[model samples]
Target: MGRKLEENLNFGETESLGIAMEKEDDEIYGIKADEMKKEKRKKKKIKGEEENQNLDFSESKKKKKKKLEESQTIEIPEKKKKKRSKAEGSSEEGNGALEILEEKEKKKKKKKGSGDGNSLENGEQKHGKEREEFEANGAVVSGNDTKESRYAALTSFVESGLPDEVLECCKNFRRPSPIQSHAWPFLLDGRDFIGIAATGSGKTLAFGVPALMHILRKENRKTSKRAVPLCLVLSPTRELAQQIADVLCDAGKPCGLKSVCLYGGTSKGPQISALKSGVDIVIGTPGRLKDLIEMGICCLKEVSFVVLDEADRMLDMGFEQEVRSILSQTSSARQMVMFSATWPLAVHQLAQEFMDPNPVKVVVGSEDLAANHDVMQIVEVLEDRARNDRLVALLEKYHNSQRNRVLVFVLYKKEAARVETMLQKKGWKVVSVHGDKAQHDRTKALSLFKEGKCPLMIATDVASRGLDIPDVEVVINYSFPLTAEDYVHRIGRTGRAGKKGVAHTFFMQENKGLAGELVNVLREAGQIVPASLMKFGTHVKKKESKLYGAHFKEIAADAPKSTKITFNNSDDED
Candidate 1:
């Protein structure tokens, strides 16, 4: 029994030892599996990092390639860019002429092709031939072409005899205005010219510069002791004559050219003396000039260039016969240049009589009688009784404003005087100019107004045309003008030298006739037309009713000749 118990104990110990060894082997196998899994994860992570680095390198290369490409392209210099922009601007200013001509040509061609051409192919071929000829003439039909382009080409090839001094003067005076740009070349080429540019558009300089150059270039011209003038400029008014003389003299100062002004208001003795002292250029009004020419003090036989400044105004002032007489006296070989703001039938007749058969017709903007676009037209409808109060209010407002120069226009000289007295009573520094005022007083008033000593000026139509008072901030029409043309000239006083301006017109029910034309002018200028004005555009039709005082009602032809006259009578019958 003792031997059996010992065997059983030995068997139990062996079995327990076997179980413990099995557990130890399982734990070691689990740890080895975990270590292998960690190694695989680390290898995958390293591969992902390499792929991300490759993508980053590729993106950097693309950016560098784009930069290199950009650097390879040519860049325009700043100075060249500015010059190109200037050329483009001039091209735009003069492009209207080319556009109009091409459009007309196109319409003609289209009509020809549609109606009587041989065939579509033949018509197209003909059109192409015409285009080639057109281009060969240096008139490129670009969508962006300009008549100035053709003129520029022609000028380069055709020998423009412009003096270096004149060219230098123009450069220093600033690039040519639209009128000068177009008219200068024609005038410089010694071609007769009829330029229709708006007032204050530098017409003085447009004609003056060319006249000076012509006089300076004359052969064997003595500086002193000359009885006859080389060039003659005829103007409508004394003020305008003086202004023209000043412009010509200033422009010709560089060329050592002498200019003198002759007008009726100033003493004739001084003018006679100036004429005797030998003047290269003579600018004068019709009345004074006619007297001087009749007295044999001034002669036009030597005059090579003649400019009728404000030609339309001269005709309007009944200087037509005088102008004809003067032009008839001038040498037929003289280059006749007429610069008018309007193109009336009379002006056309005058041009046909005096100018070359095919004179250079340079018209900036429209030739129709219209106000300057640079001036903002602000029409205020008011009762006749409210005009005074409104005028005062406007003056008071602008009196304290930074822009102080203001000009007020009236229909009558008496009204101008009354307004001046009233404004003066109101403690405003004001001046008056009219037909009744002496020339000295008129000159004094203009001087004071120009110097800003008198910030406000009241004047009749005498101050309307050819007055160049720079920096005039506003123009006030206290009364309606005699005509649409007059209205244009009045507002043109403020907006000079390409500067912006404002015009305030005091309108009344009596001025209804002007509303139609005024609305058209306002609309064409891209201004804000009042709703009140819109009604007049379609309603009012009478042209003479706005300006002239109401005359006797027109009697029907069949009616009695002595029928009772009802409307207000105009004093013009006297």
Candidate 2:
């Protein structure tokens, strides 16, 4: 009876092992469509063999179940015997075998479960094709249109509660710009967003209004003992920071919100004094903001809203670490917003770190680097060294009208000053802006340009992104920009406020890389593209470079190498 019980238990284990093997085979049943069609005749012969195997499998399963039931009956008597002799060697050995078998089955089941999870993850990756398309064309939502409908309702600035002063201030009164229309709904609802818009498409007001509204909503909350600001806006350049602060003050004053602008240049005394008194908003460059925070003068722990305007520019300027440190000091629950003209991989990574998992993404223009459609693009093919003569002739023609505000863009700081001197020698009233200029001079230069005292302004790329001077007539690229995106932004300085303007870009043989992108912009805006530019455009095979554009200035032969340092240790008393 004991031998019969042992045989029955072994037979039952063998049948269970066969069942597990058949289940694994079922998992490998996928057939490639093309391969199956080629092997259809061969498969027909195999089908008969497979049917016979299935019949045998069914019969074996039935016999196995019957054996299992019989084994259970035999095990009942064995359990009685084991109870009588629980400490016997044979009984202990039998129990040990059963325990080993159970552990092996558990491991097999675990392996199958893990395999399913891996397959599920791969399926999810395959499903992200639509998401890529939606991001590229700002058309559909990520499977939900609730937010899309809300954004669609605010096509006009009047729909969103803009103060009468702000409404009157807007050059586009009848309808909101593309960025404004898409970003208002999310910002007004206090949701996080990453907005991408062209340079002159009114991004300041897109976030400025919401910052005011958010400050007003939290007006009654008690602040810390120090005069901590409630809202903070960080920009890459001092001029841009001041421009943003001025816009915020104009729109937020009606709601009793005070804004203070802090930057590196100029006296910190006035900024500290203003912050000593309570202010609702603080707008400044990242460097000055970091200085104030380290001195315990500026407290951000109580800030309820924060905006990183021109985020891509900030990253390129090597302020990403400082920006992250400032963000860390702010309240984690704060409403965060970032705006950049181009969405690079670095910007995407920054958004992922700070924003919510599903933050609202608002893309106003084309997904790629694009110029404003309202601006007409024109390309002039010329040699690199002869661009100045062409610019002089073009300026001579456009300088006749007093309303013609011509902005000339150059590549370097020295180039800006040289051009200013050359233009001044020709009896043209020109103002130049670059990084080497003092803050006071920069302010004075901007003032003269805005007042139309200096009709033509020569500037570096610093003035490309965020200076809002009205009635700019013509933009001449005296020196070609390093990339097509910079070219787009330089031209955006003109053709603003729903008015038509012209952009003249000088293309050299080295600038053939930009021809493709420049041609696309021209074709999209319904301008006449020259045949040379169209031919050059064919060389653009893929997307433009991330940090630098197509062209980079080569290092001069006399440039000093900082990698090797020489120490002069001789002490000579003269």
Candidate 3:
């Protein structure tokens, strides 16, 4: 039993030794695996180092190439600078420098042409320059020896060659406007004159003074039994005619000359009585004057001086026939004078038919349609539904005090009434003058507006042209006009008498047709145009004739009428 126990212990010891040997083999293999992993790590590190070096080398090469390119670009301008320096003394080098500048300009132009936005910006810059030039020159004179006879602008009222009485009447005026200064020399000299100027440029006094002078110079006026007028002034609207009469009467009162305003919408009894009593000047609209002339109550036999004010507006209002009839009744040797804010085709035609061949045409600004520079035009492009809110906002901003005179122009008569009612409901003091309103009411509204009794007035195009409301601070276009000319005249109600004004216009998709013209006007006046408006496109569609549609051919106003040739056939003669 003792021997068996010793053998079992030895067997157990042998088993323990075998287990220790297996453990030692496992450790040896573990060390080998660790060494293999270490070598692999070293290889990866070497490969990474090589790749980093290559990348750094490539980056350095790229940097050198960039630096070389930059140096080349920098050296070119330096060489040009050297050339410019040499060109100062050498004509040949100067030509080279000029060529270089020309190339640069060409490149710039090319770049500008590469984008539509840039091209539009260039156009704006060009228009801005044109406006600046016009403003700087003050007036543009054309026709009939303009170079020699163009009168120097009157610096003060004293320079105006007016009788003492007339000068006394003008004492309140600070200075003559540009139109008055330029037109006075021609008109007072008894020359047929065409004065094209912006509205509110003091055209009334420009022609009124000359008419008074014409009447005053006549020698046989004192002993004549006839009560015929010697001078006639035709206006487009009754309001303008009344305004002209007031001015002429006030001016002529100092000269012992009586003036009568003959217009419709008022009792004819008073007009006829005033005419029968004797008057030096007759100012009336075409329709009323034609009626009176046809009725034999008013006569134009002694009318030697005829003036058509706002001639374009009159022609636009279909007064051409009446105007021709009135002109035909006037003395053939009458001195014809026409003052227009625009030189449209129809106005040109009338001038051709009536005015002297060499009438002096004086344009105060550009002949093209342009807004008053004194007025700041703000155009907002918004949805039609948003107009009410936007208009309210603009009113709150522009007419906050509501003491200043603000004229709101709408498209239709009902729109005017609607807007007026809307403002009235908003707790605003507003008066409206539209066609739907009676003539008496219109006159009263205008009187109230002029007197500052009513600070706000809403009207259609009736009040747009030639209604000189003093101290009108703002004009808002609630609806765009059918024509751009009306738009100009509407805003022209403000910015009068050399005073600055503001015009806020609400534009919608419906007004896209006029967007181009509006943009042009704004750019010409150096006003900002919104991008949203520009998106409507800058193409101005040709105006279609109301009667002739798109196939109408626009003939020049000065073009001679085509003669209807009658063919005489030989067979018929035989």
Candidate 4:
């Protein structure tokens, strides 16, 4: 484990930390060791310290304090799903695009040959046994079956005039993930794009490289600016924007680009001064950036490259109007890029409204795919009452790796509070994030969690969207998501940036819709769809019902009032 993470663990969830030998790039993976004594000592040492530090935290917040009750064991129920509505033909669009997709599928098939059937039959599980045998026999599959075995060759080798140094950084990044492979060419060509891919597939660098290149080229051409940010990246939340800003700083430093971030809740006077000092790139959540723009503190007229980091998230957070309003102020002759992990109907409609004709539409991964192969998927079939018992048991069983961090997601703010408290009392260092927490507290909690002061966190869907924390070992969905797309974002939190991880979902009575969709998407992505989620098997459904609301969690629970929010990358962190 990194010293930074270890030193920050005040409530040390004791484990066999000594056995966690590092790997290449300072990675770690090890077999679980059995021990309980160390955990108890560490928990006792940290409990009084943490409780004293935040004695008034809950009272200070808007929500009432939670009173713990006697623990109860929840029961698991058999799954009931709508029938797999036949082997429906691929829902190909009537336009010429479907033909292109068809051609791409053909090419994909030719590349794979035999395992395609086995892959299609049961996803990663079917291949597991055979793969183990193959490995035992020293047989390897090449071509498209490989992660970085480039489905498409690098084209438009250079775009936005990035410096040689910036390009060199990627040369050592091991492999170009699907998103990077698709977006790099278009970005290098200085063309606009609507890049769609799952999280952790190198999406940061897809846009980061182009931005860096754009700045370096500009500097080479003596095209430096002191006032306006040349590139503007937006997201829906501050945490996500902050994470994006980190990526830009890391990758863009090799080039000559300097960046800045602007977001809400912080005092704006300093941000105005930062803007006056000038920056080449600005990554920020849309709300605060817009405030600065309205104040004439931040202008976009000279911005050459505009990126909507998580377009779907912006729309989901209720920022469509604000984003459009900001876009209207920018120069019309600009390269516009929109990226989303899941392309929703609203996002598609937004793309049509903004992007130029036939603008590069590069798509990768399954529609609701989780992260890469390194991330395992599991499902727990249990009722609401038994959930706490199962979660505790599972955590206890798996709490051997101190280097590992666990993120547990719940649907309701109340449930989030409950879960966090339960875990914290159980000798696990835990924190939580929901809209109810003040911005300062939220920031501190995120910082603490990131620093590993708390290795376990109970988060809402808000954390699922775009926050990029590295080295996470697992993401547990304490409650199932309302849509298949949400499920993708939830699990995508783990197995990030080529690290090995797992996603576990606990299913119950109200989670039928989500559980069903999750199974299909997992199957399509060549991931393991847990039998617990499919105990009832697939059943045919007569028709599809209109989605009742934007998100079931948001609609069902009262948290923050949903405002029209514009989400861009983090310029505040710059």
Per-model TM against the reference: 0.67, 0.67, 0.73, 0.64
lDDT of 1 at 349: 67
Off by over 4 Å in 4: 1-152, 155-162, 168-175, 216-225, 368-372, 400-403, 497-499, 525-574
Q: Residues 149-194, candidate 4: write the lDDT tens digits.
A: 2323343435323456787667665556556756665666666676
Question: What is the lDDT of every predicted structure here?
Answer: 0.70, 0.71, 0.76, 0.64
Residue 65 CA error for candidate 2 (Å)? 67
lDDT of 1 at 412: 94
lDDT of 2 by residue, 331-383 (tens): 88998898876666566666667775445555554445556777877888888
Predictions ranked by lDDT, top down? 3, 2, 1, 4
The residue pairs found clashing in candidate 3 are: none
- Candidate 4 — worst ten consecutive residues by lDDT sum? 65-74
User: Once superposed on the true structure, which residue ranges of model 3 sit more than 4 Å away at CA?
Assistant: 1-137, 149-160, 223-226, 544-574
Candidate 3 backbone clash number: 0
lDDT of 3 by residue, 472-506 (tens): 99999989999888898899998886799999998
| Candidate 1 lDDT tens digits, 209-287 | 7788787777877765567888999999877887788777777777878889988766789889988888888898888
Which has the greatest TM-score? Answer: 3
